[model samples]
Target: MIEDLQKYYGYLFEEALLKEIADVAIAKDIKANDIIIDIGSYITSIPLLLSGAIKILREDKEGDDLVLYYIEKGDTCAMTLSCCMGETKSKIKAVAETDVRLLMIPKQKMSEWLSKYKSWQEFILHSYHNRLQEFIDAVDTIAFLNMDQRLLKYLKDKALVNHNDIITVTHQQIANDLHTSRVVISRLLKALEKRHKIELHRNQIKLLEL
Candidate 1:
């Protein structure tokens, strides 16, 4: 767990500060399907992913689940910021997508560390900027891109940089991330496969076969 923290923090911070930060962090291991946060529950801490995956989701008024995004290792859930700001209600639920480990940071200590540590401040600022850019991209995709275009772009983006192919995401997971129907994703995958552009394995999708 500490190794993951070092790997994540080392990108924007020094080892010393990460050691200090880890001092106050409570390492926790959670099982798959665990609900980290409920729709209306108050969260007193923020958890940094150390291993495995999580997802941010919400149930609409009609009780249909909408998945906002997947949180892989090193991703922090956005609900923490809302809770820190004293929001009365949670806009999303955070659930562990796999057996996961996290480094839990209490809000009060995190606030103190942010104020005192220059490295922490820089890390937060950089993270916020990247997150904002992602938000902008998601909004643009939803507003302007067609479903096929969105799916293609997402696959290309997630594909290995060198290969621009060979993505391994599942259809249901992609549907959740894209806010679309799984049946639609299945149809799209079939079309792509028929065109010899991709192939579907048991749990993985391989792209750019041609």
Candidate 2:
């Protein structure tokens, strides 16, 4: 696993640093829909995604959750970094969007590596920047776009991240992610279908265009 990780861009640290990571990091394989990090849970390690995708979500007080962004192969979870850096509990949830494999670096090493390794610092900073931009984009979508537009954007994002135009998800699931009612989502989705933007099936949505 160490040798395999060495070939990745962000994991190309110095030999000593690499050795340290190999010694302390634990590799985990998770299946789709598995909850990796739950709100209010104290995090002990930061995960480095090696394959598949993870969806980061923030839940409202009423228990409705909205997907903040996705972390795919070669990406790290910035929400996890915040928890580890502050020694606090997680404010967001991370769920496996597909079968995933990742390496978890202990929280202590996360802090140590920030100062000891240049590569790790750069990687973390880049992740933060990307996540922040995604948040900004999401905000813009909510503020400036209508429900139909938002649904289209959401479907496009899911398709892009999953590397397929076909998405296997339910209308209720889409409503949950977008923080809307299932009835509203169903109506908007039908509008999208009428416009030839997507084709809907039983628990599936196939994008016809962006």
Alpha-carbon local distance difference test for all models: 0.72, 0.89
Q: Write the per-residue lDDT of candidate 1 for residues 1-210, one digit (tens) a residue.
A: 457777876776677767866788888899977888888787778887777777677677765565555666666765566576574577778877667888888777667868788877765666566556766776687789888778776776555322446665678878876767899999988887888777788867777632
Candidate 2: residue 154 Cα off by (Å): 0.8
Candidate 2: which stretches are off by over 4 Å? 10-12
User: Any residue pairs clashing in model 1, and if so which?
Assistant: none
lDDT agreement of model 2 with the native: 0.89
Best by lDDT: 2
* Candidate 2, residue 67: lDDT: 86
